[model samples]
Target: MDLLTLLDPLMTSPLLYPLLAGLGSLDGVLPMIPSEAAILTAGVFAHTGAPSLLLVVVATALGVFIGDHLAYGLSRSVLGPRLINRSKYARRAVAVAGRQLDRRAGLLIVTSRFLPGGRVTMNAACGTARVPLSRFSPASAIAALAWAAYMAGLGYLGGAAFVENPLLGLAVGLALSFACGGIVELVRRWTARRAPRAAGAADPGRGRSPAAASRGQVGSRRVRRALVSATAAVAVLAAPAAAAATPKEADRVGMRSRLDDVVATGAVGALAEVRDEHGAWRATSGVAELGRTRAVPAGGRFRVGSITKTFVATVVLQLVAEGRLGLDDPVETWLPGVVPNGRRITVRHLLDHTSGLYDVVETLPMPPGPEFLDNRWRTWTATELVARALANPPTFEPPGSAYAYSNTGYLLLGQIIEKVTGRSYGDEIERRIIRPLGLTGTSLPGTWPRISGPHPHGYLPTLRDGETHLIDYTEMNPSMMGAAGEMISTTRDLNRFFAALLGGRLLPGHLLDEMRTPGVRGASYGLGLDWWDTSCGIRVYGNDGDALAYRSWSYSTEDLRRQVTVAVTPDFRGDPDHVVDAFLDQAFCG
Candidate 1:
């Protein structure tokens, strides 16, 4: 076979079948892959009627099923462990995941097949939870069969349509893309809504973890596994300014000036936009860690860390308005496998951090390696992280008994969202929150590294044995965090989103009130919002985010009359003190 002859399309006619199969497999690994296109093209080739539609459908399903599992397993082995060390919050999230897996084993596998951004590496979720291959494999096959059949059928229909009218094929393709995008958006919102309550802290009556509760149950299991599978870990600050914040007059232009110079110099390659009660723009500067790209705007893009909780809470309350899940309902009512005492804690408790799930992070065996210090080269699975959290005993207290910022709380809520909605967390977010609010620049990043717009440089000071070493904080993949702190976004979008949420656009009035209700001695939580009253009498609601080298935030007044978003890349050095400070001077020039 001469090289030219082999390259000839006519000479390679028989290669189409396997080639088509490969495309389906590719989509399993890379969610964005065009499995539909490959099938459609294959259908065109099937004009000769050689490969029957059934055979093609089987091939596509098998390829996708196998590829998805392979990727999932790789996530467990390669990605999950590394992610454990990425952030303290991430470690905590893993703990809740463990309990959820134990109880909702069956549903977790099924949901993976239907959800977007979820299917990409679901194998790892199942694997890390130590779920047997026997369980996941069959469910995965059945689910994939349905998915492949639907997609293949569409391809067939489109093929027939294309022969009659090419426009119809194009229209069908557009519809599928829209459907995929819509579904993704819906999952995002649902996940966001549930994030603040992931640990099942909302229901104090339940004593077993979601993972523990889920291992055995299916319709309800689907809800449990879906919710538990998506939620991530936790602790959060109450307000931007605590008693620790040195109270000062609104005239802090000097401090604001210093922070701006730091950002302009790229010493801190990011800035926070804070507006005083009088509505003045103030700047706090820092770089966004991760990939240190200097071309970031003052309002740059970053992995918004735990601040995502606020968004999730807002969406949950909105759902409450629609009566999807009631605020007072026991989390156990919606998600079956929640910790044993979960019935005692209401959704309200989980959102308020009253749940007393164990602090999984401090207990887990921290890997003894330089990877902990490196900013970029780390990965982890939800299950591994959860296991580490559960390695130690849970908090001695009962649920809703006291205030603890365990990441497990949020994981519980994530499970709740899916159970009540019959949708993935990511899908719910897109359909309910992001699309409606127009937060175009935000996403659940999962494993995709498409931070397309301009962003600041984020620094992660690598430490080896308590000293600074090489900081490899560049382009770190953020997948294993799941819904915890895994969202990528811009300050501009954050500001807009918070504005919509606080202004009463996102939720009904009563639900919004419930969302803002605080508990657990009011250390610093209001549903999903982290709150503080500035000395200037400005009541601000927002959350602080810290993920790896990136620190980002979005805050606004309860009235939505004022808003701010800050993105920063930490130097891993001096005080990360008020990343939100620098309230601009009350400079409304006469």
Candidate 2:
């Protein structure tokens, strides 16, 4: 018998799954591990009925998830980050992965599992970038499933074709995988060749933000020289210099110069505006799109993700101030039987995510591949989402005993708003905040998927059938987020709203005081607003929002004298947090 036939007993062994899981997890930290080959070999045995296809898929999927987390944990730890930052090659790989993730996190995660060394690099990059576990976990799971499916499918087909020769089946399966890899490389090359011409033809009106462009051009020569010199050393000094500098001397650092670094970190497009006593300083970087070289508009509108929570919370607080709803009142008083422990769950619990409700998004079966594209546009109602959350039991016991973020709580809050006000949350927000503040750039799109004004295309990257594809997710129904996170606003509007609210224009003093009271982490969450203490010991209050392809951040100093609002259209290309955090620190601490 051939070598493949000889290994049949081991492949069918019950220990196979655990072995794969162990190898897969180890492969995450060490890309050279032959986890893929072992998996493929297992597939060969499955073809001969020595191991079941289902078992093989399950084993590998778990293995991939476990492995990715292990790598991510390593990167997140102090020693790992230090080692990675110290290595030039690791940093470069991380930069590439960050950029890839900016475009298509799911696609890259799934496809990387097939390419030798791809998984290790991706996990390291994600860990280095500090991409939140909430985002990484689901994407990793989807990728694991895809990898299992693809490998098993190929093995099954080969087995069916060569029933008498498992050896030939294994060879056929391995060859097909290699063929897919070749196609991916070819497609990548073609795209690169077309990029320059496409960029050159882009409209000047759509060019990079002037300040960002100026900053980029000014330091281009110096940055290039530094990058070249970095080749000789494991760590680059220039990057840490700016980050390590004292806060008092921030002005000397130059805001424009910093924005250039931010753009270089992998943001497709970024715009930052700081309004202070001196006046206003605005900067932009990268391009509006990958192929187009246009700058982001001065005040372009974009999805404000969870930042919408602040607005929703503001309205809720307004109701509380007006004595329409009590903070301690049970949610059942407003929406009867919607929540499992409605009586024990208070309105404050909803706002702070201490309601113990399970996150609805976590309950659904989020499939990878083209399957997600089908449901991308599907409209979901608030009632439906609450039902989804209710389908799963509460994640914690004794409501409000612990802190956990639950979008379901926000949706429930939205329902309560409707019950108390007898109007949609959008209408209430428009009359109370948007119209009052004259935030013309902001709107509640409701079920409308299209962004109405001048805006950058929100790009999502994916790998389907072994070829990378960039998807324009610029438009999609926000009903899925509901009151929790479906609002849209520009950086300017965000700045205005936060400034006005913090300046004590939005709510009564008593309600505002209550809103700012920390319910979790001693300071992170208030009634609806959240605060973060900068590295330099200054506290900034605001909310951050994120969608599949767009992210919005708005924050201001405690005094509201200094404020910065940023909008970023993720290109799936790089880690932009370093730039963002630096800008915030300079804006506040400085």
Candidate 3:
């Protein structure tokens, strides 16, 4: 018989809740009672309206809470002292746990519940450390609730999505749970491996006099600083070896190695492309999906998020060049009473993000959790989106007085483009930029939910019971983002578009200069494009884009000779940005 057939009677029985509770409590002490499996099975059955979902959640949480406290009390009274006295390793582990508890006891306690064997270890550590009941109780309660909700929610989602085959739903839910555990374990192991290398990099003068050690450390820092400065200068100024000399194979290796590091930091997949006077090079790392061995597509299209602002801004500039729109014209002239401070806000104000408009995206249900799944397919009209923003007062009085990044401002810019050209915002972008540049991989998806081409699936990492639940968020209605961020494009298309824009193929020299000029003092953003001053003291212009689970960056040198575009589906557990920065340093600073 199949596993489900054998467990069917127990799952549908009145004894189910008490059985779940008993198993949950026993698992805390024994560490192998399969409490999670029991909970998941009950949850799957609960979806068919047998044992109540609410009862299942409550029973599981109650059992876990009781078990955790029982473990804590036993360790405090008996097991903890015996272990510490018998093993040096146990003592050292407890000492480390003590230090962590002193800093963030609640967070450590809560997150531990999700890790395999973490619950027992932390309970023993906490008890030995003499953590007070008052502090521990609240954190434990929250952990129990979060754990029950997440596990039950997972089964419910699976059941809902695959109603025709309930057994398949149960299997899928269990698989996802195991995957989350595996990812957490892998991240822990990876971190442990790095610790030794970091320790080795520290001072080697532990046996020397304090004065001698201090002097040696100072000298070492100075030498490193000097080397960094020199390397930065060479990396920034040197042309691609293909253009000036022999191909730099070492540089290509360095880029690939850095991309691998990015994946090791918990990104599911990453794709990057770099171009220069010599030629173009591409690199990818990690799997496109969680359980599959499929590689990320070489020419994958992804939602560009706020990077769409650059394209929209370019279209607005083209209108300016054609005498169809003016930079200083009041927004009131076009929209008329749509914005509270319409007369005060100008086209320049909108492009530069100095209009002080409140961001509408903040008010939407775009959180990286269950709420996103509930509303992912909901389409929104631009009028309704703008009205939501208009309902709130302007962020600041007298536009252009300060800078605030507002998607609302861009939505208004899109409306202005429509007013002037008598066309939709996406239509204008297509006619003005996409067609002219022949960027076949780029498009404004409008309300369409699918990517419509080869693309890496993006996942929203939700921390449940301290485990990372990667929800596939690859498809969603883009109309909510409107002209503020709805465009999709591949890294190759992004690179070509930026190169053409910066190379003066699209905009006139004078207009392009205006687009690159920052409106507010000490701000990084200009009219449409933003500039990044790398650690090597070289400025590269581009924009970064972020949606629910996808993020991308496109950057290039002033002359368009060197350019790089990157896209990543972040796992959100590790610091992907640090590795990305390192990759940029290698690409631009050599």
Candidate 4:
């Protein structure tokens, strides 16, 4: 069953939902799951779900209490013991506490229970102090009950209060969790006040033995060791935080607000690039895809879709540079009598996409009207898809007429590149372009493994029998888009490609002029680039692409200073333009 379908009822059903929700919170794998909201949803479903209010309280109270305490116990057993063996201050503290307990007795272990590690080690400490289990169990139970009541009360009230709003629900959940965690700490201190007087723990008058005092000295040394151990333990635990603080750390730690906005807006995922020309700093966000954990690798490969058209334009321009092919060379000269109006249409017209080619999508229905082969299919020759497209025909527009984005023109270009270069399309891209520029992250996979290295599994949204699922779509046949849209790239590689392309590294000076030359109509698209002077300040030149559940786009400033911003995903979402717009808008350079 799909996740949303499976989770929805537990969210909407009051009776079973709270119990499940509480249990769900105990799972640490993804603590970010909105467990409180899940319970609040249960409250909303109270009319139909009929879980008694008290039942929710009991279930939630018991679940969180038991779970948290278990977490503490596990920490003591594993973490606390590990600390004492290695830590100097813990060793020192153990020594100090041992000396103190020898004279004043039972003070260190009992007091140690007040510290963070102490609370965790309370059960173990009581046992070590030689305090009987009967006494320790009753006291710890009382403390545990208080802790549960406070947490559960907060949860119940928070859920009841924010049944209508999820954002509010999350706030309340965190507050309650913190409040409960804090309260447990507070009560332990208050309970410690009457300790020495209530028990003759340190009294020489009491039946305390010399050996017993000796035991306290020994255990106190252990306590000193435990203190150093605990501090070191805390430091080790804080390492992830330290790692997150570095400038080169995750872009999230730096710009969570901007990233949060993207996710809130519901694009499967997004990545933002914020940088200064002098190589100062940049941040990234949202991640690469939905339902997966890998962030978009900075230098990695992803399909750029129609963006490949621009590269083809560059290659075609290179051929034109050698005087082998002319801008006005009839396509018929290269491939005899294939196009109906091949005699009239020029290579320049195709590069400019003015070749009035039929839209393959309009002709051949998209997502190709199949369940999209469950198994990853491989090795589709470029000509196969072109033949299917050519079997249909050109647009109603005469060659060299109006501007129309056509995949057929690009497919023709790939064949042209292969025919001219006498090498595989991908090999030519590497030898001529990527390898020369040091753009290792970029690749023309051409049905090679779809983008390797750390990356989130991309997925496609599908509704089957009325249930929605984001299906992992990491693999696909390049023949579908062929030369037109099938090149894979990463944000870093794409940026580098644009940097080289726009900086006049890919093509000769005059040919680069043709490459930058805009097309007809109000739109002046030069080859592969799509230009839009937004109401916002920066003038962007790049491509917008959509394939299955994936959407990708990249842009560079006209000067190539802000080289590229590419957002790609494994799963498709309803709105990509908005995703791009929002990211660019928030990317006000520092």
- Note the Cα lDDT for every prediction shown: 0.53, 0.67, 0.68, 0.49
Q: Which parts of model 4 have CA positions greater than 4 angstroms off?
A: 1-256, 278-282, 287-300, 365-370, 374-378, 570-573, 586-590
- lDDT preference between candidates 1 and 4, better one: 1
Using all chains and alpha carbons, the TM-scores for the candidates as numbered come to 0.56, 0.58, 0.58, 0.54
Residues forming the 10-long window of minimal summed lDDT in candidate 3: 207-216
How would the candidate models be sorted by TM-score, starting from the highest?
A: 3, 2, 1, 4
In angstroms, the error of model 2 at 247 is: 21
TM-score of 1: 0.56
- Reference-based TM-score, model 4: 0.54
**Which candidate gets the maximum lDDT versus the true structure?**
3
Once superposed on the true structure, which residue ranges of model 3 sit more than 4 Å away at CA?
1-248, 462-468
Q: List per-candidate RMSD values in Å.
A: 16.1, 19.2, 20.6, 28.5
Error of 1 at 320 (Å): 2.2
Can you write out model 1's per-residue Cα lDDT over 455-477, one digit (the tens) per residue? 44444443355544324343444
Q: Runs in model 2 with CA error above 4 Å?
A: 1-253, 364-368, 521-523
Model 2, residue 202: distance off in Å is 22
